[model samples]
Target chain A: MSLQHALLGVLEARPMSGYDLVQFFDSSTAWIWAAPQSQIYPTLRRMERAGLITGDDEPRGPKLTRTVYSVTDQGREELERWLSTPHDPSPPRDPFLVQALNFDTIDAEKAHAVLEQFITEQEKAAAEAEAHRQRLLNKDTMLLKERLTRRDPAEHDRIARLKAHVFAGVAAVARTRAEWAREGQRLLTED
Target chain B: MSLQHALLGVLEARPMSGYDLVQFFDSSTAWIWAAPQSQIYPTLRRMERAGLITGDDEPRGPKLTRTVYSVTDQGREELERWLSTPHDPSPPRDPFLVQALNFDTIDAEKAHAVLEQFITEQEKAAAEAEAHRQRLLNKDTMLLKERLTRRDPAEHDRIARLKAHVFAGVAAVARTRAEWAREGQRLLTED
Candidate 1:
């Protein structure tokens, strides 16, 4: 599964405790591939059982121990194989679009309100994505900087450019969503 | 839960056999909310148990009968409530973007090829969405025509506009994806 590969990829960046991985996902990978903390612990156990990752107990404080995860050699090979493989686009699952398809059941006023709210939410998302794009471009984000330091100097430019490309893609999607919502609002108001 | 509501909405249009619903989902709703044929039968049974839908056996031949499903009053009321509720945006689960984030692990040429393939797929999808939008605008799609005939004449215009809005939204998303892919391709090529 892609989640397994994603976990391997993240662990390959640096050894992280489950708590740290959850924080990393929330702060960075949430925009790309989100996984809830509830799912993380179970998945980590599975990955360990499958020999893709190994967990070692480390002292956290006077009496506390935490399990820190790191990718195995097998995991690195698997992550690379996944990276080389072509990706299939995911199935459509947009609920707002589903509602719009059944618009005959709702009033025009309610439809307009929904469109407006969608536009507002999309605008906020676009702003956040744009800010993220700027952070990637500046090479100031923590994940980007850490990845840069870990890789060969020859890879520095490619890594920075590719990551920024992903954020730019996210911003474009948000802008298009906002644009579509505005168009829907206009259609509701006109005629 | 959204899938349940989507099923109810489709049934509100007209009674359909499970087979017909599978065909409908494949032809029409696949672009908005895809449901597998495997899930359809089980979900239909669950809905029957919940009293959200009623199934009546109709003779198809001398010895064979088919169950046709239609929305109950409770189903319609539930659908209306769902339509009135605000929707939260689904989290991103794009694997290609995840790969991009870990670009340091992949060779540049492979990344370029992947971006090119993605662009081609998105361009094809955008064209199909555009064609669907045109059909909705002309009120020529079978589903749109069916809903129009069943609803009040005064509601016809609103229904058409709303449906077209959904397709337009689809078109915008596809176009944005294509654009992002193109940008990714360029990033891979330059420097």
Candidate 2:
């Protein structure tokens, strides 16, 4: 369902085809909402069927045709509804944390290995989110530039700041996980 | 599924009826793994069918028959496998952050309202987790005490510590979210 809203949100920013949407998702902004090509096409189809979006076929070459997707008026209304609506925070269901809860079953070496693995994973995620946040702040993004043109010039910087802030929140979360892993490691040593 | 592993994790510590398991999840530890009774019954059925658990009919009274569940040797093996395995980090799909990514569409007051609501939610989560962590550390929890009795006396403190650490981690994550919400609220004011 979020994938649907995110798709509509992106289309509202700038209309693009499924291929371009895939490229858009693969870009630095992918950190915001990551969806695979497989998910993208099926969801776009569903959105089109629901009348939230529309697809127009155009000839890219003499023999090639591509469908460009854009948000319908209904899509914009849905987008606004989503923006104003309160979203429920998802419950945490981390398998690693579940494993950590049972660290008493394993030795310090094995448990330490588990915590270390978690550290690496969290650090990698934090690094990616942090890097993306930096790129967003520097205004070095292509897709965001396109999005900026859709709004007033006075609103451009805040838009970019909003995106950077979101990614920074992502980085902050990953950092907390890494810190938690380290704290778990420390507890193991005390045992 | 993590739910299966969590169920096994609980039963391995102490076996209980489906009703009792439902009560257990509703306890303070509910913060760790939140599964509804609907999900619990169906998942128990599936796990029983898979031979990971066994259900025995125990008569409580003249008219009441309860199916008590316990983990099998196979379930223990699966739990061990899960503990040692490095679970992949799930991708972030936060709807609030997704909304923040599109805040440029809404006014400052509206966006501030969004961030403010998120702050209240995060703060509530943080407080709950913190209280649970304190309960866990003081050895004042009913479930953890039962779980501790299953292990050697020498290992009891460490086991409690492990549970406390997990809840602390949860509290830390919630605090980060609340802080992030505050940051978003600040950004809205800056606009």
Candidate 3:
């Protein structure tokens, strides 16, 4: 599915081992679209079987071989097609919001506690997103560093600006959630 | 599952037929948690078998018997437990943001078009959410009306405030997304 396209998009940048891709996903794309390490190996195998990607074996140590994955031209075409297509927005499914909708079922104290906990969690998430944004802005991230090393100078700027914008978007969402939680807390406590 | 809990929570308010529950979900809870009519009947059967809810048969017409479902005492306890428990925040999975992260793979014009389309969609969503919030604020919703009729006068304000807070929270999220989309469009268009 989209994970396959995501893998193709990442490999389109440069050849990477399955381990490197997992690291990349964790460091960069975890906030937007996460795929566990357990899913990565099986997906890589499936993509290879489908001819979207190719795996080349390389010797890592004595009696050990590692497979490095790279996207084929067909994969690049598929990535482009997916990028151009419009995607339906995912349906909202916030459990905290669901709880808020049914707040009458619980006492005010319990509701206030939930909002407080949500605020704390949201603030922590916003801080992490801000840190990640700063890294992308400075081009200090491994993903961006790799792109800068391999791509044209102009393309590097495009990539950095787009990626930084995505991180900023993430940070904004986290901040909004925190603000909403604070408002809920105030409503629960105020006269 | 959360859907089961959601059904129980709504039934705790008042008894509802399966058809009525589907309408309720479509009008109110769809913003937070969505379940299709197809899944609703099957889940209801399972819940009844499990003794979480009870359905009383009533004559609808000459030949049809409608079942009105209400949460049992066990269902009420289950709902209270769920309401008191803290839920983990859902991980983000925005496909637009995912495509934005890989913007270098696509042409600049295509990227700009995508961002523009996103902005339009987000603005529409924000407007819808704002309308919903206004309805909650004005106490014009059927759900709120029912609660006002049944609950104590003192509890009415608390319920309205909490539910309105949830709707406001939804509005805020939509506005944030629209803002993010606008920013993305600007980034795409800037020199």
RMSD of each: 1.7, 1.6, 1.7
* Distance from true location, Cα of A79 in model 2, Å: 0.4
Using lDDT as the yardstick, the better of models 1 and 2 is 2
**Each model's TM-score, in the order given?**
0.95, 0.96, 0.95
Error of 3 at A10 (Å): 1.9
Rank candidates by TM-score, best first.
Answer: 2, 1, 3
Off by over 4 Å in 2: none
Question: Which of 2 and 3 is ahead in TM-score?
Answer: 2
Q: List each candidate's DockQ score.
A: 0.69, 0.67, 0.68
Give interface RMSD, per candidate.
Answer: 1.7, 1.5, 1.6
lDDT (10s digit) by residue, model 1, range B1-191: 88888899888878889999999999988888889999899999999999999999999999999999999989888888888777887887888777777765778688777777777878877787788888888888877787778888886776777777788778788889888877777776666
What does candidate 3's lDDT look like per residue over A21-130, in tens digits? Answer: 99989877888788889999999999999888999999999999999999887887888988987787777766777787777668778887877788888888888888
Where is the poorest 10-residue window by lDDT in model 3 chain B?
B182-191
Model 1 clash tally, residue pairs: 0
Segments in model 1 whose C-alpha atoms lie over 4 Å from true places: none
Arrange candidates by DockQ, descending: 1, 3, 2
Q: Given candidate 2, what's the lDDT at residue B34?
A: 79
Q: For model 3, what is the alpha-carbon lDDT of residue A106?
A: 80
Per-model lDDT: 0.82, 0.83, 0.82
What C-alpha lDDT, on a 0 to 100 scale, does residue A2 get in candidate 2? 85
Tens-digit per-residue lDDT, A1-191, candidate 1: 77777888878878889999899889878888889999888999999998989999999899999999999988888888888777887788788888877765777678777777888887887787778888877888876676677778786776677777777878888889888877777777665
